[model samples]
Structure formats: C-alpha cells, structure tokens
Target: MRIIGLLLLTGSLTMGLAACGGGDEQSTAKQEKAVETSTEAKAGVEEFTITAKNWNFSSDKEIVVKKGEKVKLNLVNKEGLHTIKNDELGIDLTADKPAEFMADKTGEYVLKCSTVCGATQDHEGMEISLKVVD
Candidate 1:
C-alpha cells in the first residue's frame, strides 16, 4: 500500500534525526566530565613530563592546579632544542634542567616555546593552556 511505504520512509527519517540529536547531548556530557577531571587533578607538587619533538607538544592537556601550588615540569627534546616559558608566571626552562614555578594567581596562562629551534617561527608548536584555580 502507498500509506505503508510512506510510513517506512518517515520512520527512517525520524531515526536519522534522533541519531543526530544524540550527538549534541554526548558532547555536552564530555565537556562536563572534563570540568570535573580538571578540578580533581592531584594537588601539591604537580609533576609533568613533556616530550618535545616534531615542533609540537606531546601533551596538550591543560595544566590544571590550585593557586599557590608548585608546578614541576620536566622537558625532553627528541627532535631539536627547546625551552618552555610563560611570561606571566616567570617560567623559563631550558633543556639543560627541569623547571618549577609557583602558580601564583588564579587565571589562565599560555605557555610557549621561547627558544628558536623551529624554522622561521617566533613560537613553535608549543602553545598550551595553563589554568590555576582558587
């Protein structure tokens, strides 16, 4: 019957729309989980190891910590030479040694590669987010 064929087509369309609608809800849930995880990061002397190669950072996860905590960063450069620097936090680390800085304030800070290791670029692929929460 004509009505049966039309009903089947309508059902298929409705199922497709439901699948699309679920995508947004899943994304929102992921965002919330990230928030919870960031807040629950281990406090006091947070140690992080970063691999520096291919002109990019190996770890893109945001460095989250409470204010007034110490951030201990260990850098390893497998490709070329590199250093990490954040002007706001006065963190300048060379490949020769590790870096430790105080998360003095509660705000968002950007860390970048200050050393000129890459080609024709002031900042290589080393920009990452640093968040200090109260």
Candidate 2:
C-alpha cells in the first residue's frame, strides 16, 4: 500500500508540471502574436514633419501622399507659434500636438494658418496644400 501511494503522488506531480508548462507555452505564443500585429500596424503608417516658421511652413508647400494610407504629421515650430487647419480633411495641427489620419480622399486640400501672427500679408500667405493622390 505504501508503494502504491508513492507512485500515485509522483504521477500527479508529473501531470501538474506538464499542465503548467503547457500554459506557459500558450502564453508565449500569444505574446509573440501580439508583437507581430504591432509591427504590421506600424509598417503601414507614414510619418511626416511640417516645420512652421515666422510667416510660412518651411517644409514642402505641397505635401503629397497616397490615398488609403495612414499618415502622421508632426508640427515643429521653428520661429513662431502657429496652427494649421483643414476643414475638409479634418486636420487641426498645433505646435504642441500632431495630426494623424488616414488619407481616404484623393484631392487637394488647403491647409491654412488658424492663428493670427504678424501682419495681414504674413498670415495670408501662411497656407499649404495637402495633396492626396491614388
């Protein structure tokens, strides 16, 4: 009877250890799958920086990107405090925050400075074009 009890205890311990190891393997697989998904999401995103100066944006006058692509626009203030907005594209960029969106429409959207800076002429020319193409 003593020998039989010892064998039962050993078998129980082995099965418990095997069950724990299986759970760990499943957890590791889930973690790896999450990492792969994160990488794929970041790979499809495009990042751009728009520098705002005293009277204009020092970056490209026409920021072009492909439609149906994820876009991330970062605003950098070089000379003055500025803000950019486009009602149609639903973009509102500021010196403190960035703008992120998916370029769903293919058209030319005007981005204008929302803040009043310097003189009227300076503010008037503080406009850029966001061109979304196929």
Candidate 3:
C-alpha cells in the first residue's frame, strides 16, 4: 500500500504544477493588458488651465511638463484685457482666448503678461515659470 500512496502523491504534485503554470500564463497576459492601458492613457492629450483674476494672472506659478509631450493650455481671464505670452518659447495667450503649446525642449521658461493692462508690477507685472523635463 506504500507504493499506492506514493503514486497518488506524485500524481497530485504533477497536477498542481500544471495548474500553477496555467495561472502564471494568465497573470502574465493580464499584466501586459494593464501596461498597454496605462500607456494609452498617458499618450492621450493632457490639459492645464490658467485663470486670470483682477489685473494679473491668478496663481501665476511654475508649471512643469515632460519633454515630447503634448499640452493643452486653457487661459481663462475674468478681466477683459489680459494676455499671456512666453515669447522665448513661442507661446502666446491672447485676450479672451486660450493658448496652446507643446514642450519640445527640457528647460525652464518664464511666462509673462504681454498686454500692458495696468502697472507692469504687482499683479500686472506678474510672471510664471515652467519647467520641461525628459
């Protein structure tokens, strides 16, 4: 009866190993699908919004972006005569309209107000910085 018990044990071990292999294959497939989904999400267009308040661009702060990434910048101005421009980077935000720019290089860029709506200081002279990274 010892030989019979040994045979049963070996058979169960073989079946268990086969089941584990199948489970691993399924897990690997699921992992690949998850990776693909995340990549697609990241590749999708990204957007950022900046609002103008009073006589200055509200929350005039630094914006960071990755190199080779597409960015959609929406500028919302409560004031009728405000403009956003980054001449060095060829980005311009006109009055009553939104502006868009893509990050092609990795560096820091200063964004300034183009329209001289008020004193070029305080809120009028406000500026922001943007950092682009790879």
Query: How does each model score on lDDT?
Result: 0.71, 0.77, 0.66
Give the alpha carbon lDDT tens digit for every residue of 11-37 in model 2: 999999988786645854564454345
Clashing pairs in 2: none
After TM-score superposition, the amount by which residue 8's alpha carbon in candidate 1 deviates from its true location, in angstroms, is 84
For 6-115, candidate 3 gives per-residue lDDT tens digits of: 99999999999987786645754564454345446655545555656556565424477898877655565555456778876778875335466678989998777776
Question: What would the TM-scores of all predictions be?
Answer: 0.59, 0.65, 0.57
Model 2 bad stretches (over 4 Å): 1-41, 60-62
Ten residues in a row with the worst lDDT in model 3?
Answer: 31-40
The residue-by-residue lDDT of candidate 1 on 1-134, one tens digit each, is 99999999999999999888866458545644543454357455676666667568665355788998888766656666778898788888665576788888999877788887757563455666778999
**CA RMSD per model (angstroms):** 11.1, 14.6, 17.2
Best by lDDT: 2
Clashes of each: 0, 0, 0
Measured with C-alpha atoms, the lDDT of residue 127 in candidate 2 is: 85
Model 3: which residue pairs collide?
A: none
